[model samples]
Target: MIFYGKQNVNKVDIEAVVSVLQSDFLTQGPAIEKFEQYVAKYCGAKYAVAVTNATSALHIACLAAGLKKGDILWTTPITFTASANCGRYCGADIDFVDIDKKTYNISVEELEEKLINTDVKPKVVVPVHFTGQSCDMEKMYRLAKQYNFKIIEDASHAIGGEYKGHKVGCCEFSDMVVFSFHPVKIVTTGEGGMVLTNNKDLYDKLILYRSHGITRNQDLMTKKSDGPWYYQQIDLGFNYRMTDIQAALGYSQMQRIDEFVTKRRYLVNRYNDLLKDLPLILPYQIDEANSSWHLYVVKIDFNKVNKAKVDIFKEMKNKGVCLNLHYIPVHTQPYYQSLGFKQGDFPNSEAYYKEVFTLPLYYDLSYEEQDYIVQCLKEVLE
Candidate 1:
């Protein structure tokens, strides 16, 4: 059956990991730094911290940003729970901004309105790059400056995407940017993530937060070192370090990022062209952002289509297609609802969740396979 997403791993990726296995250090070693440097340079950022996963990257980023109890952290409701859970990990109150109907990212207009009217402003606002398309970060950044809130871009779907001619992880528009390297993401490190930042202080904090908050550097220590072996646990942190094996694979994957993005974009165009006549709302592109097309999601106009959403999924599955939903609004989840986020809290996001679904789009998806997917979709809709 055709899956919604898949990783593209070549011989080079395998060889890189195999070589790291033969090396002296497998966890905290040269491979990690090398991979970090490559990602930083590619994204035009000053520093990149590799971690175990995107969730951990977001966790450390929130901690480094001084998110604590009673502070507010805001993100779009139409995202993976990890986007909101990261704030909860810091004991911060998690709130959600509604999504833009077209872009499916956080509604910048709503965010500014909320900022202007609310008594409590967010300590940090995480704008997710949904479906690899960046939100209107320039406007978001302007609002942030005016309101005195930090911006942490949850760019898990957008490693190679560009906004206003700058790379997404450049930190030109946000304080920090996070990337995921899961098997189904734009790149694969088996399972890894990275946080990129331009501020030296934030970079230092992220480094400390990723590895038990311990530091061997004498400058950061409270007292002078007793010996070369002396270290200090300066703050509470987690063991979120990325292993050399994962880093090596990530470095190799970095070499082919452009190729991967180009292939995905090509397939996205194909899907857009083939599915144009169907009763679906195709992905929309904003003029300022060039998406990486990590996911090719379309909204079914159920008013025009006779089938229920579940029945469409069932029919597609029976026909060997495995379509998937990108998200359910985070506020509607039981945990968030118990936190007092009830239905009708975010109308646009809840409306979006009912109609949108992801189509297969990945680096290795061939034209023939894509045509078959379109055919299956056409049959189901017809």
Candidate 2:
């Protein structure tokens, strides 16, 4: 069966991992710094802190942004819970804005209205780059400047994407940006993530936060060391460090990010052409953005079809097409429902949940496989 998403690990990626296994240090070593440098340089950011996963990256970013009790953190409910859970991790009050019908990112117009009308100002606004397509960050940044709130870009789906001709993780429009390297993501480190920023202070804070807030650097320590072996827990932090083994794999994957993105875009274009006649609304890319195309989702017009999305999904799966939905609306989850969030809290997100499903998309998905998948989809629709 064709998978909706997958990792494309070649001999080079395996060799890199083997090399790290033979090295002296497996964790908190040179490979970690090398991977961080590689991502920072590629994304055009001044500094990057590597961590175990994107959730940790988001948590550290929220902490660095000074989110705390009584602070409001706003994000789109269309994303994974990690997007808003990170705010809760900091003891901050979480709120959500609806998504744009076309972009599937946070609605910039709604965001502006919310900011103007709400009595409590948000400490940070996380604009998720859903499906690897960037939100209108330039406009969001303009609003941020006017309202005095920080921007934390949830760029987990957009490592190789470009926004307004700049790399998505450059932190040009946001105060901080986070990336993921999960197996099914654009890049894979087995399991890893990174936080990018142009600010030195945030970079320093991220370093401290990733490793239990301990500092061996004499400059950061409160007092001088008695001997060579001396460290201090400067602040409360977590064990979120990425191992050298993971970093090595991530570094190797970084070498082919451009190629991976190119192939994914090719598949997206092919899907756009081949599926245009189908009763589905295909993804739209704005002129200013070049997506990494991590996912290719189409919203089915359930009104036109007699079958429900669940029935169509089962039919496609029975035909050997392993399709999956990108997400359920985060606010509609049982956990979020306990927080007073309900189904209709965000209408666009709820609407998206009913109709959208992801197709097979990865570096190694063949044309024949894609053709078969589309043929099965057409049959299922009929």
Candidate 3:
């Protein structure tokens, strides 16, 4: 069956991991720093901290941003729960901003309006780069400066994307940017993530937060060390370090990022042309942002299509095509609902969840397979 997304691992990726396996250190070694530096240099960021996964990366990023109890963190409800859960990990209150109807990123207009009208203000705003397309971060950055809130771009889907001619992880518009290297993501490190930042202090904090908050550096210690081996626990942090094996794989994957994104874009354009006449809303593109096309999501207009969504899913699966949903509205989840967030709390996200489904998109999806998937979709919808 065709998958909604898949990773492409070549001979070089395997060789990199094998070399690391033959090396001295497997975890917390030179390969990890090498990978970090490679990604930072690629994205034009001053520093990067690699971690176990995107969820842990977000957790450390929120902690480094000074999020704490009673403080509010706002993000769109249309993302994976990690986007909001990271804030909660810091003991902060979680609130959601509804997504824009067109771009499906956090709405800068609604955010500003909410800022003006709401009594409580967010300490940090996480704008998710949904479907690998960046939000209007320049405008979001302007609002952040005016309102005194920190912006941590949840760029899990946007590693190879660009905004206004700059790379997405450059940290030009936000304080920090996070990237995911899950198997199905644009790049694969088996399971890895990175947090990129330009600020030295935040970088230091993120470094401490990724590894039990222990510091071997003498300058950060409260008192002088007894010997060279001495260290201290500077802050409460977690074990989120990425292994050398993963980093080696990631460093190798970084070399082919452009190739991966280009192929995905080619597939996306083909989908745009082939599926244009269907009763479906293809992914939209804005002028300021060029997407990596990590996902090719289409919204079915139930009004025009006679079949129910579940029936369509079954039919497509039977025909050897596998479609998937990007998300269920985070606030409508039982845990968030228990936090007093009811069904109608965020109308736009709930509405979006009802119709959207991800189509097959990846580096190695061939034209023949894509045509077959599109044909399956057409048969189900028509």
| Highest-lDDT candidate | 1
TM-score of each: 0.99, 0.99, 0.99
lDDT tens readout by residue for model 1, 1-382: 9899999899989999999999999999999999999999999999999999999999999999999999999999988999999999999999999999899999999999999899999999999999999999999999999999999999999999999998889999999999999999999998999999999999999999999999997889999999988999999989999999999999999999999998888888888889999999999999999999888889999888999999999999998889999899999999999999999999999999899899988887889989998998888998
| Model 1: worst 10 consecutive residues (lDDT sum) | 263-272
Report the lDDT tens digits of candidate 2 across residue range 168-246: 9999999999999999999999898999999999999999999999999898989989888889999999999999999
Candidate 1 steric clashes: 0
Deviation in angstroms for 99 in model 2? 0.3
All candidates in order of lDDT, best leading = 1, 3, 2
Clashes in model 3: which pairs? none
Q: Backbone collision count in every prediction?
A: 0, 0, 0
> Could you tell me which residue pairs clash in candidate 1?
none
What stretches of model 3 exceed 4 Å from their correct place?
Answer: none
RMSD of 3: 0.7
Tens digit per residue, CA lDDT, model 3, 84-160: 99999999999999989988888888999999999999999999999999999999999999999999999999999
- What TM-score does structure 1 among the candidates reach? 0.99
